[model samples]
Target: MTSTSGARSHTSPWELYDGLTALVPRGVTVTTCVVSRWALVETDAGGAGLSSVPDDGRDDPHGPQDVVGQDLADVAALVRSWDRRLAAIGLASINAWCNTQERLEAHAGDVIDWDASAFERSGELVQGRRVAVVGRFRHLDQLASRCDLTVLERRPQGRDLPDAAAEFVLPEVDHAFITSMTLANKTLPRLLELSGGARTTLVGPSTPLAPEAFAGRVDEISGSLVYDAPWCRRALMQGQGMASMRGALTLFNLRVPA
Candidate 1:
C-alpha cells in the first residue's frame, strides 16, 4: 500500500531528523524490545518497529541496561548516537511510534500503485537506464539483468563499490535505490546531495516511513509493515531477519510526485 496523500513538511535534508522526531508522540513507552542482529521495539500502544542492527563489531547494545519500559522519546533521541546499534534501536523506536499514528488506510494500494517489492515492478522503469543501488538488496539479480547497474556497499563484496564511489557514480545515474541504513549511519543527507538529479528511493525495513522527513530528498519511500508485532519481536529474539519474515511483513512503497 502507498499514498502521495502524505502530508508534507521540511524540505531540507538537515531538518529530516527534526521531522522524524516530531512523528513520535510524547508519553508512549516501549513495552517490549529486542536488540539482536535486528532491533525490534513494540510500544505500549501496540506499534512495532524493526531495524537492521549494524554489525560494526559492537559486542552488545545497552549492555543489559534494558530498553523496554523506557519513555520512547529517550530512545528516539539515540537515533543520533555515534554507537550504531543505539542508532538502529532509536530508528526502530521512531518507526514504532509513527506506526501508531500514521493513517495507512488513506495510503492503501487502491489509491496508489505500490508493489509488494519495489524491485518486483521495476523492469519497465529501470531497463536500459543507468541504475545505482545502495546496500546490495538480497534479490538484486533481478535488477542486475535489467539495467546498467552499480551497487555501493559499505562492506564491499564481489564487484561492489564502496560508498566512496557515490561521489563519482550517483551524479551520472538515471535512478538510485538507496538503503535506509544511510539514516542510521548518518550518511543519508549526504547521499541525497550526491544523488544529484537522479530519481532516489529510500528503501529497507529501517526506513522511518514519514514522507515529510524525506520530502525533498527522495522520490519514493519503500518500507515494511509488521503485521504481528509480537511475532516479529519473537523472530528478532531468535536472531532472525527479513528472510524469516515471510508471513509477518507487507512491503510497500509511497511515491512522492515531482
Candidate 2:
C-alpha cells in the first residue's frame, strides 16, 4: 500500500500527484469546504485534507468560491493542476488521494507513530553535526546545544538567514530539513538539488505521505496524518492553527529506501 515500487516511476512530485489522483474513489461526495486560516475539505467517509490553503485574490483563477460543493474526487485532481497556487485544493486532496496509505498506516505495520517527538527524531540525525533548516520551525531550542544549526527562511527573522543563503549553506551542511510546504509552493525540486550533499528531510503538514513524491530526493518525510476528522475540520473552520489541534493528528515518519 505504500507504493514504494511505483515511486521509482515518478521522476517529479507532480507525477506523484497524478498517480495519487488516480486512486481517489469515484462517487465520493465532498460534504464541507471551509477557507479561513486554512483551506479544508471533508468527504462523506471522514476524509479531510489538513494542508489546503485558500487562494487569496491575486494570481489564482479558482478561489475557494470555485471549489466549495464540488465533488471530492474532482477537487483531488487539482493536485495536477497548472495554477501552482491552487495548491490549497491540491493539499486537501492528500486525504482523499492517499486512502490506501492511510488504511495501511491504520493497521500499524510500517508507519512509526512519533506523537509529540517527531521533531526530536528529525533532530537526532543532525545532533552534533552541521545542519541547515529550510524553514524556521518554532522548536529550535530542542536541538542539541552542540549542534551547528543555520536556519533559512523566506522572510528572514532575527538571526535566521534569508532564503538566498541556501546556495552558500546547503551544500556544506551535514543534514537539512526542508519544509514540505515547498510542494505546494513548487520549490521542492530546486531545494533538493541545492541540498544534494546533506541528508535531506521534508517536514511539515503539507507534506504528502506519498513516498513516490520524495523518492530519491528526500531521505525522510516528517508529516502528520489526520486521525480525528471532526477535530481537524473544526480547527480549519474556526481558523485555529495546527499547533492548537495536536489531538487531531498523529505525527508519522517515512524513510525513503536507499
Model 1 — TM-score against the truth?
A: 0.88
> For model 1, where is the 10-residue window of minimal lDDT?
1-10
Look at candidate 1 and tell me the lDDT of residue 179.
88
**Which tens-of-lDDT digit does each residue in 39-133 have in candidate 1?**
88888887888877776634444462478889998888777776778888888898887643244555554223443677777777898999999
* lDDT (10s digit) by residue, model 2, range 1-258: 112222233355566556556667677777776655555667777676666352322345444446656777788776555455456666676654453345536535445545544467755556688888888788887773647889999888988998888989987888778887666666666777777767777787766666654566667777776667778777766778877667877776766654
Report the number of the highest-TM-score candidate. 1
Query: RMSD, each candidate, Å?
Result: 4.0, 4.4
The local distance difference test score of each candidate is: 0.76, 0.66
What's the distance in Å from true for residue 20, model 2?
A: 4.3
